[model samples]
Target: MMKKTISLLLMLCVIRSFSQDTTQQIMPGRQNAIHQQDKPYVILISADGFRSDFAKKYQAKNLIALGEQGVVADYMQPSFPSLTFPNHYTIVTGLYPAHHGLVDNSFYDRKRQQTYGMQDKKMVADPYWYGGTPLWVLAEQQQMIAASFYWVASEAPIQQLPPTYHYFYNEKISIDQRIETVKEWLALPRDKRPHFISFYFPEVDHAAHSFGPDSKETAEAVQFVDESIGKLQKVAAASGLPVNFVFVADHGMAKVDQQNTIPYPTIDTALFTINSGSAVLQLYAKDKNSILPFYENLKKNAVDYDVYLKSTMPASLHYSTDDDRYNRIGDIILLARLPKVFNRGGRPTGPGKHGFDPHYPDMRASFQAWGPAFKKGLQIQGFENIHVYPLIAEILGLQYDATKIDGKLETLKKIINTK
Candidate 1:
């Protein structure tokens, strides 16, 4: 009898450990109150290249309503270079661009001498390229379901696992289709419902890159997205389910003209090359010594662009070099403050773009939150891109280290009910 009793105790201990691993941090928590919802959900929306000015200029009625009814951060300044992949990764991992990887829109790997662009999903989706626990992986590890639509890095595996559901960025699909897909998942049977959902709208970013951010075309795209959000609001209300809706932009946009471009040598020998559009260029260095001479040539001979060593990028940008992101970033980083045409093989490109420093107001992101959990009429200001990870962890009632992030949780506490 004594032997049998001891065996039973040992089995109980094993079962308890397994159960804890599956159940821990499943639902987010406030300091005092364990929110009494059946299972809380988050609908994260990324409005790519969305600037607060668009919100101010063309009336985003649905977003404004969401802001007034819920919570709005005055402005969320994006991380360095104000690029897409980096900020999107930061939003989930609570790490800066340096820590999380996805350093820039297009970067060159020094050791490999290859360039990686976000559009090339085949290469950019490697799990080894990223670090830290992305939110989707964190949810999955705790046994919760998560899904994403057209968000950056969604196609990549995190922690060797994919989100429960994901759409691998089909540009052919209309924005309406994207909204419907999100609604369909939310409409799933309670047992199959996704505990977290992320949605991305790319039309505005595309339009801004083609036209300019301040142009009417970009404004129209903003309105179109706002209308879609309005539809999402209707669906969520009719369902009467407990959910948190977060709307954030990867970065804002900037306008460039004839002045923004710079021409590389007319010959195509290809020591270094510019990829046109935003004056950013890629350099193929024969040796480390070539980097400085190349930068000097652009400054003295070209006279239109400014360049920097990827490793020694300006301090204010808060970016990292020699890591995953920097590997893709060109050996020499270029920004054109003055208007000029830039071309490596003398081929011209688009009229506008972004992905420069985040300090510029035009690069600041937009933020809005609405749900049962948030405080109505609460306003937060000066929130940075990295802070979003910790804030979302708070909403999910999960354990997170806010200190590991450049973003802060205290600023969001006013909107969340601690007790």
Candidate 2:
């Protein structure tokens, strides 16, 4: 069995995508709530840059065991523009970036002179840039306790309800310490313990950025995170917590050499400032005409990347849901094909990066669930990450307000088991 898993991973590595597609599909509509199971605690773990096959490729025993013992999907397709902040929030809000405002890892708000950037501590905490209610906030509003050790948007008070035990985003915090804190949280009495908790680990992502996704460093990073998961499992066992688990990744990494990139000067900088880069980039243009020079260049020249006016971006990406979305996304969007990366005025690419079109097979994220609320040993078809919110809401028995969300729980019925 291990040999077969390894063989499958090797094939996935070659294709840079995993998961077999199935014709089984479900369509649950908006503003609809699925039946909730009472009081089953949930722990959501987001391992950034964790490719669909990274666990099997590196022999992550604990995670593999959980998948074998629980409900597992072929994969989880990330929302389009498969960037970190956008997709992580998408998981919690059940809304695409078009509806929930974290349009990219970086975006600008003219009125507030605010920059919704991943690296900006202030911007990350500002509520104006975030839309919809994250799972933690919704859980808290329904008289249930919630917490986030390090999920995106956990640092802010979205819809004015912060998670009961939220922590500010700090990359310096070690994974061991984060797990220890969660162990303590889980050990609390049932009433005092958070009903919903989120944890994030960036070792895999950080290492993959420095060493290519195919490099030994990424494998080592995977092992490190896997061992951490082993420890977390032990802690959960010790606490005797009745928590369900959902392990996920914001998006998968694709290999691209840092040393080989097209010079940024090749694009006309005067017309638009490059707001993001790598497999995907968002452009904030000075004006619509300012974008024409490069628009014509991509059309006239055989370029490696695809360019689109925000309004004309492939409808499949769902980036331009409405006419007013342009202000958040800017006038143009750029997508880089695999093996090709954009160099933003000498911005270096590392061994790997994500933010590609989420539809690409390799760019798909990981999704596995185990415990009371999920079926055991069931491998179902992959679905969009947006549906996660409804699942979490159902587990907590949360009566959430879903004004701006796109996620629907009925579509994911195969994975959910009852109380």
Candidate 3:
């Protein structure tokens, strides 16, 4: 009896481990349509917190070489309040953060009367919180197979469909193993292969957040991503398919005044609920009548930051009341000026942070693409990240209603080789 009990406990441990790290979540009974088998392949890669100048600054040889072989943009401008989840989802959906409903990394939804946070696993995977048609969803709706190693909203069933091939977000898998899986996907039969794939790397972002962006640790992390991309490209080339690569970053990083962090302003709990971040803060008023009084008081005493109501926000940001399609933008918003951030918990703040105004030079993102379909040795001017969606859709011959999306095909059409 003792021996049997011990065996049962070991088996239970194995089951729990498998449940936590289920590497692949595939939607069976799905295959690429016959016409899609001949379509071009695009592997969209996002290296988090990889600043616009990181490649040249860190001497990322592989990415530099890839840019020379194909097309390179001066920089990619992320949407306003450039947080990770919002900008990433914007890139895939071709909508501004406000229009797509992911207003911030963590935000309150008035309709649900609930908070959506990046750390909340249930909220992260819940489809109801996400809006806009993600690239994977768009492809699958058209009968094309799509895969994702990991991308924001990829695990969620947006439009009642997740990617045909995807994985729950986890860090346990080695980079080598992940690359091997991509190779395996490409090697599958024509109908079973995925034409559009998304891959993400979080090492640079992690290192930069813990250590300053200029720290040696952050530099090493950049090199790691550079080397990993080099390996992925080499393995992908061996697949004998006309695979295209679009390398991008969600947003850049900046060093802040960690020693002199700003503490959250005092407010009555009964009147308002607060969602705060290092770079931005939002106050949701429980009573609409109480908003102006608090806004006026905060504005009078505000320091090292700027405050704005949804109706009064700068139009250039595309993040005002008119843009808040899902009503997730706070009743009152606060944005910290550069070199300073808010610390609501009074904890030691990290030196490196993002979620700043996108117009700042440090907030710019990186964009590079190389493949058979692109014009070789061409360098282009900087453009908004939203334009990327239409570019990818055009290359893959995927149809989308241009009227609904903010991206315009003409913005990036010049980069592709039509002849």
Model 1, global lDDT: 0.70
Q: What is the lDDT of residue 213 in candidate 1?
A: 77
Query: Which residue pairs clash in candidate 3?
Result: none
lDDT at 335, model 3: 92
- Report, for all candidates in order, the number of backbone clashes: 16, 1, 0
lDDT of 1 by residue, 106-215 (tens): 66555565666775555656675677788887766666677887566766776765677776565666667666777787886665567778888887998988877777
Among these predictions, the greatest TM-score belongs to 3
Q: Please, what is the TM-score per model?
A: 0.82, 0.86, 0.95
Alpha carbon lDDT at 409, candidate 2:
79
Off by over 4 Å in 3: 1-19
Candidates 1 and 2 compared: the better one by TM-score is 2
Q: Tens-digit lDDT track for model 3 on 9-40?
A: 98677545533775688899999999999999
> Is candidate 2 or 3 superior in lDDT?
3
Q: What is the Cα-based TM-score of model 3?
A: 0.95
